[model samples]
Target: MGEAIGQTIPLGVGVALSPLPVVAVVLMLGSRRGRSNGPAFLIGWLLGLVVVGSVALLVAGALGPTDEGEPAAWVSWVKLALGVLALLLAGRTWRDRPTGGHRPELPSWMRTVDGFTAGKALGLGAGLSGVNPKNLMLTLAAGAVIAQTGIPAGEQAVALGVFVLIGALGPGVPVVGYLALGERAERMLGELQTWMVRHNAAIMTVVVLVIGAKLIGDAVAGLAA
Candidate 1:
């Protein structure tokens, strides 16, 4: 059980930390109004990630395995694939030069901001993953990992619920990590508007392929060991 649980963590992280959620946060938060709504946006961004992990738990629990093989090869592949994906994504993001992809850019005007509502911002932030294909694929992969572990659906659900809350923290650490950045950073991301349109598509595609390779790579390495 411990080994199974241990194995699931990377899968969960892979699913949780993909660029879709991060991009959504960056995109929506990059909006002109997003700077003013920083607090709300942050809250919502986190809630949205929670929704994603929750989905993973629910799906994994729902599709409980009836028969299974300890496919160490597959698992190792998954790890390698995930790692490659991360590197690919990092490369793309770096290529696009978003500075801080997970964090948004704030505009000069919104720098010294006024009152902002957390509720509305949260609403938009929650929608970050709504149309994101990356989020869907990542979440499904995680669900597969969870269901394959032989844990009861109920327990898997619980674990995923917890993971989402924790997972969001990984990408969102900056929101809390740097206070001076605040809304300004979120708005400035808009500077990438032109760049995102021109380069983000290819970057995103590379991220997907790379992560898949990483997953497969990890699986193979484990099998070798």
Candidate 2:
């Protein structure tokens, strides 16, 4: 258990950093949602999470049962520990996040997303978040974590659903936070947008560095075990 727990530190780290494109899209939404549009950015982000999470659950259910082979007890513990570690890494990012900076901008394609349908926000978020390989990676990672834990099939599906929900949160939480802090984001975006072009490289380097460390750490931890 202790060994497995130790290994998850890296797994969680990887999960924490895997949603760049989605995150970028959420960022581009920025203060534009509520202040600029009608609702808060959180509304859209939360919508996206709900959509992605639902699809992910369906995918997990379809995955249908944990693998037959049993892993060492240590692996399970590592997965459990990885969950905790992922949370910790998230905290580290929260603490280290720039004192004042808007969410990062994304490619022009993301701007076209419109959450006005009957499915509205969730559909938009899902379409963007769904087809991404990151979702597949996390779903697979959830299987690893569950299989290692020796959970039964039904339970494994449930566990995968939950982990994927948390994974979706990588994008969900930030937009919510930014939306709640819309005024702050607006101010920060204002200031940063002015000089962001010059600092974009450095800022991105830091974001990538942090996320890369998380992913690489998890990969190594899984392999090491």
CA deviation > 4 Å runs, candidate 2: 1-12, 22-28, 35-69, 72-106, 114-120, 152-162, 189-225
Residue 70's lDDT within candidate 1 is 43
Taking every candidate in turn, the Cα RMSD to the unseen true structure, in Å, is 7.6, 8.9
lDDT by residue (1-225, candidate 1, tens digit) is 454455546544544454434444454454555444554656765566556656655655464544554433444454565556555665665575544444345334333333335565567556654234455455545555665576765776665555455546533643443345766564554444444444554655565565566566656665786
**TM-score against truth, every candidate:** 0.52, 0.46
Clashes of 1: 36
- The TM-score of candidate 1 is 0.52
lDDT of 1 at 39: 45
Q: Identify the leading candidate in terms of TM-score.
A: 1
